[model samples]
Each structure stands twice: as C-alpha cells, then as structure tokens.
Target: MAPKPTSSIRSFASSDRFLAEIATDARRPGYVLAGDESFLYQRCRAGVLAELAPPDQRDFCLHDLDLAEVPIFDVLDRAQTPSLMVPFQVLFVRGLKTLYGRGQKKEEFAAIDAYFRRPNPSALIIFVADHLSIPTDLRRMDMQDKERFERIRETLGDWCGIVELSRVDEGDAARWLAAEAVTRNTQIHPDAARELVDALGADMMLIASEFEKLALYAQGKQLFLIPPQHDQAQPVADIPTPTITLGDVETMVLAAKQRSLYELTDAISAKDRPRALALLHGLLNASDGGEDSAIGHLYMLARTFRQMLIILEKNVRDSRAIWSVLWHGFRMPPFAAEDLIRQARRYKSRADLTRALRLIARADLEIRSSPPDKRLVLERLILALASEPKPAASGSFHQFAIDL
Candidate 1:
C-alpha cells in the first residue's frame, strides 16, 4: 500500500499539546521539527521517542545520525530500508547543513527532496535543527548563506511536517507556569507566576526544572499569609503552600531577588547620593564579596544607565511606549519596565546618564586591572556618580573620572 500524505506544518506553543497529539497517537512517517531554542526541541524530541517504541524495541527500530558526522545519503538509505523485527523504524537525523557552512550539497538536497516526495511507509524519519531559522538581522549572513537556508526550508517544506517550537514571552510563560502547577496538583498565585516568569526570563526548560523543584516543595502543603504583627495572636512561622506566593518564590526559587537590582537603579535615579552609595555597597557585598563581585556591578550599572539614556532620548511620555521599547529591545518584564520608565523621568538630561556610565566604566577598568584596593575604587566611583556635581569641576574629580 502507498504511504499517507505528509501532514501540513503545525506550530505548538508548548510540549504538552504536542505530546498529547503526536506521542500518544500512531506515529507519522516524517516530521521536520525546527527552532532556535535547543532545549525545547530536545524535550519535544524525547517525548516523541518515548511514545514511538518501548525501551527494548528502541534498540532495534531507532537510529540516531549526527548529520555533522554522518553522510546524508547514509541516513536516507537506512531510513528507506525496513528493520526485520520491528513493524516500524525511527530515524533521527540532525545537523542538516553541510560540513563547510550553512549551504547544502546540491546532490544531498536533491536526495532529501526526493525522499520526502515518496517517503517509506514503515519508517518515521525526523529532521531536527536547533538553529533551523536565521536571525532577523539580515546583516548577520551573506547572500550565499541566505540562499542556502532558504533552500533548506523549501526542501523540508516539500515532504515533512514542519513544526516551530519557539520560546515563550513573559505573559505566556506565566500562564504555562500556572497550568504546570495545576498538573502537579498544586496552584501558583497569579502574582507569584508573574514573578517566576520575570525572574527566569524565557527559558522554558529551566522554568520547567525549577517548577518541578517547587512542586516537590509544595506537594502536601496549603498556601497561607502572615498577618500583621499587631493583629497576630503570636509570631507566625512555618509558611506552607500548595499555592505558591511571591515570598515563596524568593525563599525557594530565586537565589537572589531581581527586584533589588531595580531598587539599586531606583536609588541612582532619585539622586539620593548617600542612599545610592550605600545601596551600591550592599549590592557588591551580597552573595560573595570580592573584586570579581564589583566587576559585574560595574557592567550592570552601566547597562541600567544606558537604558535610562535610551528612555531619556526617546522622550517616552507614557508606560506603553516605555514597555514597547523595553519588551522589544531588551525583553524586560512589564513590571520592571514600568519601574524603569518612572525612574528615567528623574534624569534631567542625556548628559547625566552619560556621566554615570562613564564613572561605571572607569571602576570596571580598575577592577579588571587588579588594583590593590578594588573596594575603595568602586566606592569612590559610586560617590562621584551619585553625588551632585559642583559648579566648578575639581582637578581631583577629573582625575577620578578618566576620559571615556
């Protein structure tokens, strides 16, 4: 009998839906799963394999070919040839691009194009690429490489069922976390879900792993809140939860509060010199106190000020415009983005933000140069940046603030 026609390309936001449809059902003859997010693709691939055959049967039916090392023709030949004992065979081929670069061998491309036209009835061939799509920046690739990538997509489009498994944004991430918590027989507060999404950024696999830890932690517990001390009958302890809260997130999930980073930025914006210096000191001293610690502080502070400069130059009047810039440019969470927008208004002009970045860069360089007193250099830099400037710039001030 002739094989079934290949299904049209379908996109999945998460692995759960894909597993429910593909893994649990009769396996298709061919699949082309492509994405830049390697971890998500890997998880989906594992799910596919688990449902394809049993552990013992996998040895006989399964074939993994690293196309980086294996020839395309060899992969095709094995996929076409049926296994004697197994009713169905699975061929996993990776690294579709040829050895030299993104371009494909004409012969190999033709071979794959042909196979997709008339795929094997009993074999399930999967072409997986962690970097199937190119970056949106056209300048990053040459004309030849672009054509090569286009050819690859065209070839895959001809025969295989293509699916895009891209990363999720903050809102989607929050919903996914809530659903995940429910599956684990627990619940995550809406605020707490947003907090988790913001803290972890957009790595779904990392989020999944962290969620598992939280699930285990909250397995048999119920959510509770501590009453105000004056209202409380006694001092409350042992906060347990099936419903995870923001406090639970800080204590259990996050190693350090990301909000503190924004708080430090807030202090700098308020132009409260003493408070800014003290906050900077506390930040450097947190986790592990050393020269290396001060180095990251320099980078982070410089980045924050640069962002503030962007906001200042753009004349962002509303939170919506601020969010648009941050979400698109920096992938910053909505809550933090709003906070930054509010703070950016505090800066009078571009020069103020520029001056702050200059001070941070000087401190960063000194830290890297292995100065004897790294802490003193950092403190001096912080004081200079946070403090109001005098009408007449001092010689010592210029000495401390090297020309950037």
Candidate 2:
C-alpha cells in the first residue's frame, strides 16, 4: 500500500472556500480580502474574473478603482447604477486603508452600511486590505496588526464577507511546489521543494515565479539527456523522469545563490564596510531591477538577521543543531549553514543582532517612502550595519551610534 500523505499537503482552505462561493454564485455584495499574501490574492481575483467577468464581457463588467483616486460615494454610485452594456459587474477596490484614516469618518461607514443594506443584485465589490500582514500562526500576529484586524472585523465583517489570505506555511508551500510540478509533467524531489521554499523565505509569489523557470530548466535537461532518435520505429526503454533537484534550486533561484547573500552577511558581521558596500553594489547590479529591488534585498537581510538572532539565542554550534533551532521555511540552505553559524557567532550579543534588524527595518521604511535615491538609502544602511558600535560613556546609555 502507498504511504499515507502528510496533512501539510492540504489545499488552501480560506481561498479555496472563497472560490467555491464564487462558483456557486453565493457571493456577498462585497468582500474584504484581508492580508498581504499576493499569491492567494491573485488566485481569488482570477476566480472572480473567470466566473463573473469573462474575456468578452470584461470590458463592460470589470471596474478597477483605488480609494486614493476615487471616493467611496462615487464607487457606491457606480455600483448602484445599472450598466446598459452588461448584466453583471465586478469592482476591485484597492487602498482600503484610506477609509480608516485619521478622524472618525462616520459618514463613510454609514454609506457602506446603507449600500450593503440595499445592495445591487448585479454588482460585486472586492475591497483589498493588504496593508496588514497575517502570519500562518494568528496568535503571533503583530500587536498593531491585531488591532487593525479587529477594527476591520468590527466594521467590514458585519456586511461584507472576510476572506483571509495569510502567509503560506513552509510545509504547505513545499507540498504545493511538488504537486504543481506534477501538473507540468515534471517531478520535484522532496529536498528540492524544501530548499526552494526555505530559500525564498516561503514567499509564495517568488516561489511560483522561480518554479516556472525551474520547470523550463528541467524540460531542457530532459531534451538534452534523451536525444531525439532519427528512426521513429525504435522505442527507448527506462527513460529517466525529469526531476528538479536541490542543486537545481540553488543554481537557478537568485536568493538560493548562497554566495551572493551569505557573502554580504559575512562582510557585515565582520564589520568590513568597503567589502559590504561592494557586495551590495554587485547584488543591485545583478538583479533585473537595480535600485527597485532594494526592498527584496532588505527582506533577505532582515530574515538572515532574525535567523542569526535565533542561532545566538539557541547557542547553535553546528549545522545539525541549526536545523532544529530554525523552523522549516525559515532555515538557510545547507551549504550556508556553517557559514551562517560562524557569522552569527561573530555577533557579541543578541542585542547587536536586534540592532542590525532595526537598522534594516528603518531602511525598509525609507525605501517604501519613495526616496529620490534608493541606492543612497541602501548604502547608508549598509554603512551603519558594518560600522562598530561606539562604547558607552560612563554617564551615557549603551547604544549603537548609528549615523543614518
């Protein structure tokens, strides 16, 4: 008998159930898609469009609006007014945070309440609440995010359905990667699945994008391995299946390139400012999006710092122990295990690693604020991270003298 499958292979119930509702035409007047998981959000969007707005009818039926540009009253008016060209309409509204901005906007909530009370039968609205981040374990949610989610529940939950698009668990991501490869007539080794998910920090959007490239790479490998025979009559036996291995994942995925990221961290941990700056430039130059990819770089940096923090806290001395300390999806690649442990040990204390994380977080905020020179912002961040913290004076408090 075949071995029992792991429970981690289960489908994404939240989005899948929402899709089922769409298919059965049991959707509410509006829905609040709560979370920043882009992969699930896209899946939900595709399902809605496929069911309500077919290709031919999309021109007349689909409306994409942002609250920053359009007011809630205008959106309601458009929803209420029947379209002569189409029988059904779908509206996707972004920038939902604008609604809950400063001041108690009783009028907006009242308007939303009134519209849902007597909603149009032919219209559907999807409010994207991506400003918040919901982790796989809801109990560990950020305090501020918990408050925001509660406010949303108290307000939007009353009328519109709330569909959460939380972060995909590492196990689920690995299973999904394996299952997805089967659909393309390819096989992904279990090790490869784990490596891919862990290397990309279990960010589903990146995993999906990189998986496509790996699939194509695997196809090319198969073509090269089994050369086309000139005689059509002869059939070859024992053909090897096209499979993606852990090596392939490390080779193709940019983040999986251990040398690129680990080397940068090595320099940072050693306080090699010049080398760190050079490595940063090399990373930016190699990426398809030079300055624009600053956020991605910062994410990897923050993740690495967090991993190091855990390593220090646990006193992980070897590669084997590192695995147990860092959970699935958050672990570094095997080749970098020793390197990372060494780097983590270079830190004097947990406070130093947390300080590094705070600097990275600040850089992330500066990048998102639309800085005129993103490269300069990253350079400043690197310089601060690579510099040694000044010793505290007798009277002064102990703190890292961050220039940025």
Choose the strongest candidate by lDDT: 2
Supply candidate 2's per-residue lDDT for 258: 53
TM-score of 1: 0.63
* CA-lDDT, candidates in order: 0.67, 0.86
Tell me the TM-score of model 2: 0.67
Q: Cα-based RMSD of the predictions, in order?
A: 9.0, 10.7
TM-scores, all candidates, are 0.63, 0.67
Q: Which runs of model 2 end up more than 4 angstroms from their true locations?
A: 1-11, 230-237, 259-404
Per-residue lDDT of model 1, residues 1-404, tens digit only: 11111122112344455555565445456776655666557666677667775678988998888888988888988888878989888887787655336554678778877876777887888877655543324455446656755655676765666655555556666777776676676888888777777777656676777778777766634423554453465645675446777767766663235567778778767767688777766666554657766776776677778778888898887765775565444544445777887888897777677778777877788888998987788778867776765453465643333342
**Minimal lDDT window, size 10, model 2:** 1-10
- Give one digit per residue, the lDDT tens place, for model 2 in 195-311: 888877788999999999999998888766554663547654666778999889877887677568899999999999999999988887766544458898999999999999999
**After aligning candidate 2 to the native by TM-score, how far in Å is the CA of 229 from where it should be?**
2.7
The alpha-carbon root-mean-square deviation between model 1 and the true structure, to one decimal in Å, is 9.0
